[model samples]
Target: MWPASRIPFQGRGGADFVEFSQVQDPSMSHKVQPLSSLDDLRAVLRALPGPDDTARAAVIAREPTLTKPPRSLGRLEDLALWLAGWQGRHPPTMKTPRAHVFAGNHGVALWGVSAYPPEVTVQMVKNFQNGGAAINQLCIASGVALEVTPIELERPTRPFHQDAAMDEDEVIAAFNAGFTEPLDGVDCLCPGEMGIANTTSAAALSMALYGGPAETWTGPGTGVAGHALDTKIRVVAEGVALHAGAATDSLDLLRRLGGRELAAMAGSVVAARLARVPVVLDGFICCAAAACLKAFAPDALDHCVLGHVSREPGHQALVAKLGFEPLVRMDMALGEASGSTLAVPILRAACQCHAGMATFAEAGVTDRV
Candidate 1:
């Protein structure tokens, strides 16, 4: 019951890009059971599905037979095994990879938390619709479909420094919006975000979840430096302190400190796990959203990997905290899934090499003594 249409975009030199229609629907899709309260979501999280060990064993057996020496491909071999295990099939394919970018506004942007204004969120979303953003070209090159979901761009969340970013009901609604995103036929999912001052929300969420100093997580988002950066750090500290006692759990912390887009990202991660799709998580804010799941369940993020390490100062530390090694590190900080999209081709290559290579017996190459 996804409400959007799929539009075929013609890229340069006859390349085809699958672009998902950017229509917002508030109702839950019939494909996913609707959540009535936080308890429903908590129950679902507690009972998450795990990877297929059978498929993983198949990869392990086939890898040694390949024409190359053991571990010659390094992480590529690991990536292929991960894909097979999560997809529940040997010789896993990336035939229908997709990226979802969630956009929302933040009330803290009004307090100079970011260099960009909240209105920029709407404008950038429009740019995404028009296929003008960097993510569009990256998706085209990577041959991945693109979907943009704007979560009430006109209604920014309440400033967390002064109060809860979202009430329980509001956060649940946003979480459902992402939880219901259609994953039919998708082999891999790349989740990213686009929102003004969302980095501030991410910083605050991280500080609350990890018990780190606010300065350790806060960084210059949207090119804010000097006093603006100091203000961002102060705001994150105040927001975490205000909500520290009220957050009974990680999900509660997300509701208290996370924006609509962040909550939606968390929901999408859940959706991908339920669908047996491996995920490539984007930069700082996107990873922070996924980290909530890790805090909830120790192995909740077993099927996810960091697509790239952002140039943001806090991202490297967050990645370390999550115990994930990024696939790429280009010093890129532009969100909207730019970093993750760039990784799609790399994953595809990993699968291709694992599936396409012949065994030494077939290749008539003598096995090592």
Candidate 2:
């Protein structure tokens, strides 16, 4: 179930300057007061088209190039349609695209379910802050705005350690905490994860949702070997059993294994969807959190774009179930959306191709009809 804490409807903290203001009607110069309703004009904008130069160029190329005989551009025509539908028009727009990367560690890592140490999450977070991480560099090159969310979901307080465990309320309390900024006007957002041993948490969560072997989804996380990998699988299996015994709620599941970074990513995705922004997913960690949001609102899946194929065994299973295609195939295990950022330029180039090419008529080519 979702938390009861409300996102205030009227207070536009981050979007203060974005709200519409009243316009003067010079024709009715009698100095009369306006309707004082912003909704009147905003309503019209809601029905208008959504697009940027890339999308509009796609519109000009709406027609397929026919063969001298007949029936050409078969697959290309269909691809155009798919892109159009996403924009709610004939040409899809890729505008103001950006990425949001959330990072955090998991408490379940103490159980030996993963190969990496938790300290690496902190190290990576600092790396991201300094713009040294792969995701940071790729996003810079791709012209994708990046936002790093620092979450503390899986981190332990002095009161609750792994030995004592936690109940539903404790988990829910952690989720009630909010992010510092809003994700509006971000045409496309991508969710990434950071936590050294997070694959253990990911495998456990995948098992809970999909019910498969711990080994089935487990993979070489941060480069662990034979005996260590075996130990990691065993630990994940045990943690799954432990969480099942607790009979935790959805939020509880998020807090217990999803980690704080996962929660932040999940929350940001939800917020962005409500604001009508699209999101691209990095790897297993983002996919795991996407599953959580999928439980709340099935439509949220519409906004996620698949980034890359992960070396982690479970990533393929999760992506398949989510019904998305991974854009890249590198063996990326980094917690950041480095893989997705790498593919952003390709998407941008695709949009550019759609926009910059001349139409059949513009080029003065005769129609075959």
Tell me, by TM-score, which candidate is best: 1
The TM-score measured for candidate 1 stands at: 0.94
Residue pairs in clash, model 1: none
Tens digit of lDDT per residue, candidate 1, span 213-264? 9999999879999889999999999999999888889998899899998988
Cα RMSD to the true fold for all candidates: 3.3, 10.2
CA lDDT scores, all candidates in order: 0.86, 0.57
Candidate 2 on 1-369: residue-level lDDT in tens?
Answer: 222222111112332321111222546322212111223212322333332345435554555542222235343343344444444343444555666666655665655545666677777766765556676667656767666555553353211113223344433333322222354444456667667676766776777677778888777777777888887777677666766556434445555555655655665555454444556678888788778656444555665677787887888888877788877888877767777777676556555555555666787878666
Off by over 4 Å in 1: 1-16, 19-30
Question: All candidates' TM-scores?
Answer: 0.94, 0.72
